[model samples]
Target chain A: MSAAGRTVRPVSIASFAQSQNVRKDNERNEAEGLQPVIAEVFANVGITKDDVDFICSGSTDYLIGGPFSFVMALDAVGVWPPRAESHVEMDGAWALYEAWVLFQEGEIDAALVYAFGRSSLGDLNEILTLQLDPYYEAPLWPDIVSLNALQARAMIDAGKATEADFAAIASRSRRDALSNPKAQVRHDVAPDVLLEDDYVVAPLRRHALPPITDGAAAIVLAAGDKALQWSERPVWITGFDHRMETHSLGARDLTVSPSTAKAAEVAGVADGNVDIAEIHAPFAHQELIIAEALGLDDSVAVNPSGGPLAANPLMSAGLIRIGEAASRIRAGQADRAVAHATSGPCLQQNLVCVLEGA
Target chain B: MAERCAVIGVGQTHHKAKREDVSIAGLVREAAKMALADADLTWSDIDAVVIGKAPDMFEGNMMPEIYLAPALGAVGKPMFRVHTAGSVGGSTAIVAAHLISSGIHKRVLTVAYEKQSDSDAMWALSVPQPFAAPLLAGAGGYFAPHIRAYMRRSGAPDHIGRMVAVKDRKNAMRNPYAHLHLADIDMKMVEESMMLWDPLRYLEACPSSDGAAAMVLAAEDAVSGHYPPAWVHGMAMRSEPTMFAGRDQINPQAGRDCSADVYAQAGVTDPRAQFDCAEVYVPFSWYEPMWLENLGFCGQGDGWKLTEAGATAFDGDIPWNASGGVLSSNPIGASGMLRFLEVAMQVRGQAGEHQVDGAKLALGQAYGGGSQFFSMWVVGSAKP
Candidate 1:
């Protein structure tokens, strides 16, 4: 604990909504794509924009090839009377953290958090390359898959895992996706079949990669009394924290996630037994790494909503993990869960949010 | 209620058109180190970091905070990045305050910066959208027409903008850190400058500068009297749909709402009488008068009177931008935080040459994205 977390106010997820994950969505623009999901999320909770004291979003200009993409996405909510709103360049999970911070301030009763990514709009691989170290790494244009492969290779060299371990994780994640209605890539595949898949980079295989998804998601959060009033079964967020590592790939121990472990500890993820966890690992091998960082035993079910392997929507995928974990608690499927979000190359930055059912 | 938060220290890099002397990481570290030094703290003492900037395209790096974390000594520490257009700088500070005020962190470090020389801001902002109207002109071009409308509606004289240009440039002469210190600057020079966007002469507009602004925020209990802290009385942000009918771009409702929200929390019933000074974003000279009206410093359509009457100068009653505001130095992303940092400087009695004498209260505001986004804060010398 940072000493300041002692007096943290309790917050809860009142509602969650998402657009169907898809490989292409040429039919709608970013705002248009987000409109229905925003309305549905608010409607699902029986609350409107007026109920939200603040609004925060996560998105990137690279997705749309322009700056201030969230500016346009606000139209979906009809931000009238100039509501309090902000946007993050990272993931919606971060935006949720901002909202959570404000909610803890005890001024605002509730907040709206949303994120949208049109990965299909441009070259996802090329756009992501821009996130690299411009001077030393981006010039090389090592795509994200290759970077993940390097991490996987490091993991393999450390005798921590193998290519088969990555395949088994992917096979299980996709098999679980069969029940998720919004999943973009859902199918029953044997681990043996996945092991035969061709390598996209070196140690990374096609089955280990997440589908390129264009999707949007939203989460409505309420604080204190508002939480009790908004939803019949609000999933209380008991602990939340995010930690970042160094930027240089060579500077860090690629096989270990000290950042995720620190975030999980700060978030109090291990205070009680985790019933389930929705981890945001865009790549399968990374999931094993983060799960270890969280110190979750096999007894704790992971990614009940298929996780990012089912429908990885860049900016929204991380937020969806929180929603997925919360939804399980809301539905009485689980009592305690930890939702994780990762960013940067090889999951250098991570967020862990511990949720509980009352 | 939220815990009281205060600005214990503030620091800013010298604004310049191109800071080739330092890399982007070095540029921000300069401000961060200075802020830490001012606060008598170290990297290990800070609990977290919250950074904000405009578009990543400005530096051609996506979410540069990932790389900046090491420079800020944020590894193994909670870190957040805020990007809300130009208002990001102000909002970044607000988010940091929340970390303290919400009892999440006792000490938080926040920063905003822009290395415009790394990439052409004009081209970065003007990137074409597939389904929307092309932004033919950069920010100035988009805002020039709004400036024209304010002139037509307020019936303000053309010289109002020129006078503002002269006054701000003159103020820059006193600010050693200001990018444009035109010692010989005058209305004639402003008038003779090329009209980049009609009604917005080159001299009347903000220069593209590279700079960073950083601040150390602490919970009131942590302020052990090591340094004067600017108590954050209130902080707020508001954003509206970027494009819509009946949107008053001249005096945006977001700006009005943002100021009203912050002022109300800070108990500022009358802005002109309540605050000792302000640091407002005025990229183009014309925005000075427009924001004066929007911020409730004066009645609608009467803002030009303030600028025209020399009421907004360093020697004026409610002196604004005494450290030479965005009009003199604009590191696009850091411009908003400079407004915030300058206000803190004023209230802390540290704004060297341009300090508002015996300043008790101060206000800072920033707006961005076609005037649809707004962030503002009120600071005071005394503990709130």
Candidate 2:
């Protein structure tokens, strides 16, 4: 195969840790909130900072309303002698992808990946508006919820899904959250009752929206000998890839996720049996769109850990999906699984990672 | 093992104080188009695109990569964004190069840019944070004391900084794309310039400009451009804390370790003798001497001696910043990448008027955030 299309070397997720998801973490700052999570990830594998050859993080300065927020967050790692490090403004899932790419180079045996965000810091609805095209969409100050609603409405008009389906997804995800200790929203309410809730936007009820969360997550990636030493049942990342669609909403088919489909195909998510999937869909209708794009069957258990619906930490949500899927495999819940992450409005970009146990 | 990678194309915009004619997307696409044209490739040929910038607050846009995807022809392709403060530009290129080096993609395009004219950088840098003392004086005030510290430690004469200001500006006149072209730049003019931060003159500092830089990196088998490829010999990045007890701000261990790692990878026992030239991030005139010692170009405290002897001039044996560097055109986020691509230009003999004669190997370096974040690379004419 050509270098561009050839598969990448497999890397194992040795350990994962995250802070308790909350609406407002007023007590701890970014570094303070991340300190315990970073320590827990390292401690879980009985290793120190020196064990990892490289470190990478995913975060945004916009969350803190200051520049270089990642700079101060480095204090949590206590890099006294300095370390080989890099940061991405996307999300923790991309950070993991970056470290995974470096592992393929055969230069490093282990790496640490992390991400943190506090959605409670500012007006998230207004702040997210700035992510639109400054020359066109941003001038109108379109809220994120309205954009997602447009997609939901598009799905309804196409006869692909209904408001009831959105309610059903929200009901199942929140019910699953009852078992997840770190999840912020957990309930056993029925879909019919959820349908009666007031709409934050037309066709989208309050339950369909993700809860505001302040949280941090960390994952340690191990290759070769380190994988065997750290994990009893190593969950290897067999394939990983991400794709982006055009930013213009009018140019895309909002009822479907072509980016997700393309990324899933490239990551070989359907090459084998998928026992479970952890999908990062902030809105209820998105879960259905992404699941259909992934080509998953009814046999596949989706969002067993409640997914973004239960705890959608801005930059950390996508990474949490990968960690949750890897954890299920390590726990012997499934032999193979698919994890998905998304960025941009209406899932304009998507990432897919296929994991399997040895 | 990693696959060999090379820079097949490089391009930049005509830097200016304000590119009012172009939007953010227009500025970045201008550079990207030039890079693709130089490589003899189209947008479809690029498998992925990676972009980097200083901060979202600089332009009041959160993660502009999402908006820029369509403009850069990233739709239906993998798009990545990197942010590591001022060093983000260099690290951004390193990440794009790795896509090829790791054999994941045969060809990759990387871009770094800054439109500081969109907003006030000083205001963005001085925003007060809870529980931390605000940087009320902006960047210059924060670094001026460091310059004073270096002056005290090195015992270098004050005139040494004026000499560096004179040399870089004179070199800028030869580069058409440079933001500052002071035709009559000299020691007298530099001395007469008004002082901003104590011990640092206004003319001794970098000019705020709007620009972008881009490059197309390809695997060894994929290199088929019009110009010679600048082979990737070594690349590295190191970062330390912003503050700590007993930290040597003058000669940071992070900078030393970063250079040491790259030099080791390239098998350079003596950087001053091995590399033909370097494009180091000297945002202030005094930084030329300070970074000279920090980058191991000279022994401790002896960096000023090289400047005083005219060894760092355009005609000097080891010319620095032949492309004018940050001292002439600083677009914050794009400044670091200018160093990286300028070195690539040197090795490829595509530097045009500022081309260092017979340049075969060169170094590119950038640092950010209180001189803690460091990224460096060594490129050569021959493949590793």
Highest lDDT model number: 2
Candidate 1, residue A143: the lDDT equals 88
Model 1 stretches with alpha carbons more than 4 Å out: A1-5, B224-226
**Model 2 C-alpha lDDT versus the unseen true structure:** 0.93
Worst 10 residues of 1 chain B by lDDT: B220-229
Candidate 2 Cα misplacement greater than 4 A, ranges:
A1-7
Per-prediction TM-score to the true structure, in the order listed: 0.98, 0.99
- lDDT for model 1: 0.91
What is the TM-score of candidate 1? 0.98
**Model 2: residue A179 alpha-carbon error in angstroms:** 0.3
Evaluate candidate 2 and give its CAPRI docking class based on DockQ. high
Across A108-201, the per-residue lDDT of candidate 1 in tens digits comes to 8899999999888888788888888778889999888888899999999999999999989898899999999999999999999998888999
**Interface C-alpha RMSD per candidate, 1 decimal:** 1.1, 0.9
- Candidate 2 chain B, run of 10 with poorest lDDT: B309-318
Q: Best candidate, TM-score-wise?
A: 2
